[model samples]
Target: MPAADALPIPVGAIVALFLAAFPIFWCAILWLIAGMGWRRLANAYPANSDPPDSADRIRFATLALGASVRSANYSGSINAWLAPSGLWLRPILPFRPFHAMVFIPWAHVRSVASERRMLMKLVRVALGGDVPDLVLSGRLAQAVLDRTKAKKR
Candidate 1:
């Protein structure tokens, strides 16, 4: 046999290719699986607005932060705010640019779910259970508004 034909492919090279490609394949599979599951779950829920035409309709979800409400401007357009306690959304066009915030409004929201256990697990791994505050200030705002309305009557 020729010396060139006698040399075998190295195991290390095969492993190196697998190691490099595995993550990308793993992530792609995970995303596809999660997306399908999510799509099914989403189909199970009635659209928060059944008619789908009403801008007034709002879907409820927990917000991880509340500071977005004060600093974010909602003066002109309909806005949705989420925090750990609850959600706040109003219909209007915001005339001013908001600061000190990255806001994700409800109108722009496509889906939500309580993955707190998963988050807690990640937090435990990364920072040893030092969980950040997940207060729902948006719901509190609604509650206060309700109470004020009740008091006025």
Candidate 2:
């Protein structure tokens, strides 16, 4: 094939290109929506929330976020609250807040349990929502559940 040999691509090729690209395009949109939606929820919460009372401070990472809470690339460990009422999963960047923050109520939690995850214990909390579950560290999850007096299953 010479430098200027190829003419305009065939219509079939164009259609195929679009078909292949659409999935990625749609995925990006959905991801943006999920992140923004959670960000809005986070901002809606009182930023001046009373300082964690008997709160178990933990290094929390938003492993995922969205209506589905799919797996993701979470970075920057931040201080989070596993309150007597809910779980605040988000980074505490002084100025740059994560788009997918979380605050989950205990009443909406269907179960609280733990299992081995690699070298650490992973506490799985089943919730009642579009994203019905979260995996946090055992130490933090246990402390929060104990304080909230939420039943475990």
Candidate 3:
């Protein structure tokens, strides 16, 4: 079907459709491209180890802003933190302004030694709240902790 003839078009619906479709579309594109490259790299050599024993106590370093240290291992996965409505998570690179993007595998942080605000920031962000660039949603932070705790059993 032609793009225009498929359905009735309203200006607001068009905008909503774009908003709904753009991220999923781009993420798929990026994942396909990145996954292809990652597969090639993995094929060239053996993996260092298995994915994980069971997503156990994997401590991830967090900066003051609550963002975990960036890693090249990022694959396309959605992670979020949860917190009360007041906080938010903002993505950022070291020494740079915040970003709205969330990268995965790299962001699959597993543990922390102490409780901190940056961690809270991450929780806020994960909950899809308006928070600083480098943060996680509080809900996600707890989920990570819970996952680790479960692994101990």
Candidate 4:
């Protein structure tokens, strides 16, 4: 009996195969994200704001150097600047064109609460319905609350 020869692999066939498999690859990625649970991104950075006042003494978050920040549509924390106007949450990584700075105006913040999760207390800032909430360490949270409260006074 003659040995069977390998079938010729055509470029067109290979392209067609990839085209068929691409949707499956995309679906698998979506499925994985959904299975892991989808958390909405938060935009903690605000837009076009005044510079920090020398006399007012803004409270910058030292701990925010590597903190994870989120808004309604963003993930990962950026450095924060607490001015009398509001809290400016900007990307820790520099000059990200797409990443936005979220400015949570003192008026926009509905409340700040401390909750225990993962055996740690986190300060949760509720930014009303227009934005997602922010969770920070208790100390930083207190700092935010103080700044916002001071603004009201």
Which prediction has the highest TM-score against the true structure? 4
TM-score of each: 0.24, 0.50, 0.24, 0.50
Question: By TM-score, is 1 or 2 better?
Answer: 2
lDDT at 119, model 4: 82
Candidate 1 — which residues are off by over 4 angstroms?
2-7, 39-153
Model 4 error, position 15 (Å): 26
Ranking by lDDT: 2, 4, 3, 1
* Candidates' RMSD to native: 15.7, 8.7, 14.2, 9.0
lDDT of 3 at 125: 20
Alpha-carbon deviation at 22 in model 4, angstroms: 21
Model 3 poorest 10 in a row by lDDT: 83-92
Query: What local distance difference test score does each model get?
Result: 0.33, 0.55, 0.36, 0.52
By TM-score, is 2 or 3 better?
2
Residues 72-132, candidate 2: write the lDDT tens digits.
3243354567666666666555313344455666676677666775696556666544453
> lDDT by residue for model 4 over 1-153, one digit each (tens)?
544684478789999999999877766654443222122223334466544654232233432221233222223334666666666665444323344555556777778766776886666777555344566664466677677666668
lDDT of model number 3:
0.36
lDDT for residue 90 in candidate 3, whole number 0-100: 22
Question: What TM-score does prediction 2 earn?
Answer: 0.50
At residue 89, candidate 1 shows an lDDT of: 37
* Tens digits of lDDT, candidate 3, 30-109: 45533422333223322233333333221233322334453122221222332221112222233112123222332333
